[model samples]
Target: MSFKALIVDKDDEGKTSAGVQTIDESRLPEGDVTVAVEYSTVNYKDGLCLGSGGGLVKTYPHVPGIDFAGTVEASDDPRYTPGDKVVLTGWRVGEIWWGGYAQKARVKADWLVPLPDGLTTRDAMAVGTAGFTAMLAVMALEDHGLKPGDGPVLVTGAAGGVGSVATAILAHLGHEVAAVTGRPETADYLTGLGASRIVAREEINETVKRPLEAETWAGCVDAVGGAMLARVLGQMKYGASVAAVGLAGGAGLPATVVPFLLRGVNLLGIDSVMRPHDDRLRAWGRIARDLPMDKLADMIQPATLADLPELGRAILKGGVRGRVVVDVNA
Candidate 1:
């Protein structure tokens, strides 16, 4: 009846600290289901929650993992029963509620999705929220008429989680992938993930005087956002769609309307959190069927609950590459 979890707490002076602690079962949050968590993952939001709350975590003694995969231990919801495999992402669970940085988690059944058939719990965590958002982006692009033969698909922030998965999935689907990264050292790694070309971060990260450049990318999965996204808009082929997934570069978009007005370009905003159940199922199914497992494996860097505090900080600094799968029980 007890579980181990990484708890982040703030002191009277406003300093925040995080560490693994044993928690009683009675302390679990109100929910229809209780899960024996197998794996969880660190995300940029997790970093904020682990630290000063970043305006995302509104309370102390918080659990910061944004996504988790596990098996149901108990359930009041008819859709799930004990022993059912499940996954949780978004819904601000880690920020506004207790989350899966624990050996056990209690959550609303509505926020849980059955793990796709081909992906193990570990694989689910490896993909995490970042990869899930990436899949949504790709689906959005496809829905807007993007095709493999049209031209190369650009994946900005290619060495990071969303970009890495997007590059791999796009490449496996026969699209030529152009990966953009600030770190030149990751070029070989990106190539191994099926990127046909590596575009330096400098090549496309700045704002341009001309709002419409020579139309280049047929589609884009942009995780960098900010100026990079603004610049990418100008480079999109006529009527091409760019899926905006993150603001790692920044949140402000200093952009002009020329790309949208003159070229009929579409900017699609992707939000994995608060996604509908049907969309979650569709994305997970596509991930299992289209994303190459070996590539996902290569993107994984394993960690334990004890490793979260440091990993959380690292992710915020953009020092982490690929995905970090955290084994909560380890």
Candidate 2:
């Protein structure tokens, strides 16, 4: 059988291009199960893989969707049978292997998780890797003793995917959410997602001379690293933790560790990729229960496989808002 996919290929001239291509099932890489992909999503990593590899792509003719939801078309593994709904993220499937930006995907059974009972394939893709990572960040903060009444939780990059989901989930859990965004235009949108206050990016993006500032946030889910994260550290309430999720601002941390040493602040690093199967199951189950479907609906902007190239560029430029759910078969 044959299917259509968005393929990113590099030419001998060293330029790369992405477009739709027809491919045969025989071309799929080794795996225990074959999935009829229903939906995929564009992430910051997808933006990199779609353009110049971002050092994440190890081979050419790659399909760059890092997260996907689908139904099993065929399977040799006893754990999954044909027609089983599944979701996949991480394990470097999109970067080093053929991924879900296609009508079909073949992957190891271990890389697949049964779609949680409350989520459809489209719903699963709507959550994607971004939302999954947000859930993990929230879980980490909660495990470290964060509670709704403790103090306001800050969400940096509040209009983006991870931040948007984090804001919604935290607010749903009864925490007061303070959203930080560079785009003033997204203030209403962020508030609609449950943020009680909007903090301008300028308000917190720079480094301060004082190593320890006034303690503010009870907890934080930081998607913008670099200086923003450094500054946020100084504002965390005593013994509070900030879950570090992304480096949208930059990778370097140019601040002192005064908050950690003097105030007992904690910076938790979140990695969705290579997460254990048990953790994956736990996160997805929590997402199904905690993340409201209505709010998820508000955060989504729909797309198809053909829109990926432009969306990829948009994400790289930080122009995309919320989650972009890609219908692979659309």
Candidate 3:
């Protein structure tokens, strides 16, 4: 069968272009399962893959959605069968393989997870890789003894995909959420997502003046790395942990170990890609139960395959708000 897809290709000179194209099923890579993709999502990585490759896309003429939700249309694996709802995230599928930016995707059964009961395919895409990573970060914090009454939890990049979901989930879990955003216009939006206070990005975007500053945040889910993460590390309350989810600001860690030594601060690195199957299932299960459906609905801004080019650039520039659910069949 022929299907529609956002095909990203690079020319001989290495210039890249992305546009909607009709793709044949025969062009799909090897896999045991073929999914009729319902929904995909835009992430920072998608922005990269859609544009210059960000070193994530190795092959040209690629389809660049990192996460997708769909129903199995065909399968050789005993783990999944036709008509089963499933979700795919991580394992570098979009970067290295033809991904869910198409109406269909064929992937290894190991990369698929049964869609948790409460989440529809669209809802799963609403969570996507970004929200899935946020959930993993939250789980890490909880495993490290974080609790609602412990104190305020900070979410950097609060208007972006991961941060927005993190803010909502943290708030719903009864924690005081302090959301940090550079966009002043998103303060109301962040608050609506359950942030108790909006911390301006300027307040924490700089490098740490002192290795040990005020013991502010009880815990944090940091999407902005580099200096902001360095600063947050210093400000974490004694024995508190910060789950490092992304490097939106920059990758370098200009930090000191004083927070670790003096306050016993923990910097937990979260890797969403290549996560174990059991853990993926656990996180998705937790998301269905903990993340509020209404709030997830509020975060959604729907798009189609045709909107990808602009939305891709928007996400990389941090201009895209909340989750962008892309209907592959739209």
Candidate 4:
């Protein structure tokens, strides 16, 4: 059998190009299960893999989708059988191994999770790795004692995938959500996602001389690290927590300990990749129970496998909003 895939290859000059191509079943990577992939979504890492490899994709002619949802076509593992619905994320699948930018994917059974009861394969990809990570962040915050009505919860980079999902989840949970975005045009969009306030990127993105400020926010899900994180540290209310998710702004944290020491503010690092199976199940279950389906639907922008190359570049440039669900078979 053969399937269509977005195959990325590098030339002798080391430049990379990606396009949809027909792939034989014999070419599938070694794995315990074979999935007929229904949907995949573009993430920042996918952008890198689609373009220049981003130091993540090591092999040429690689498939580059970090997350996917589908039905099992075959399985050697006892935990999954043919016709089982499954989802794959993390474990560096797209980065170090062949991934799900195709009509089919073969992967280790350990990396696959049964799709949560309420989410369709399309909905699973709509949440993708970005939204999954966002769910992890929210869980981390809650585990660290964050609660609704403590004060306003902040979501930085609110228009991006992680931030968008975080904002919606926080709002649905009864928190007053303050969404931060550089694009003023997205204010209405954020509001529709239930954000009570829109904070301009300029309002909290820069480094501040003061280590502690008004202590405004009760909790934060910060996607933009670097200076924005540092500034947010000072603004968090005493005893508050911040789940550090992405470093889209930058990797460096130019911060002080005043917020941690004096205010007892906590900084919780969230890592969705390589999470334990039980933890993955917990987060996905929470997502199905807590995250509103309508909000997730609103976040979706549909695409096909042929649309990936352009969408991949757009995500890297921070030009994509909400979620982009790719129908691999379309």
Residue 221 displacement in candidate 4 (angstroms): 0.2
Residues 145-243, candidate 1, lDDT per residue (tens digit)?
Answer: 998899999999999999999999999999999999999999999999999999999989889898888999999999988999999999999999999
Candidate 4, lDDT over the whole model: 0.93
lDDT of 2: 0.94
Q: What TM-score would candidate 4 get against the native?
A: 0.99
Model 2: clashing residue pairs? none
lDDT (tens digit, per residue) of candidate 3 on 77-165: 99998999999999999999878899999999999999999899999999999899999999999999999999999999889899999
Kindly list the per-residue Cα lDDT of model 4 for residues 1-330, writing each as its tens digit: 999999999999998988999989999999999999999999999999999988998888899999999999999999999999999999999888889899999999999999999999998988988889999999988888888879999999999999999999999999999999999999989999999999999988889798989979999999999999999999999899999999999999999999999999999999888999999999899989988889987789999989999999999899999999999988
Name model 1 segments beyond 4 Å from true. none
**Candidate order (lDDT):** 2, 3, 1, 4
Q: Give me the runs in candidate 3 sitting further than 4 Å from their true place.
A: none
The deviation in Å at residue 132 for candidate 4 is: 0.8
Q: What lDDT, from 0 to 1, does candidate 1 have?
A: 0.94
Find the 10 residues in a row with the least total lDDT in model 2: 58-67
Model 4: ten consecutive residues of lowest lDDT? 140-149
lDDT to native, each model: 0.94, 0.94, 0.94, 0.93
Backbone collision count in every prediction? 0, 0, 0, 0
Provide the TM-score for each candidate, comma-separated: 0.99, 0.99, 0.98, 0.99
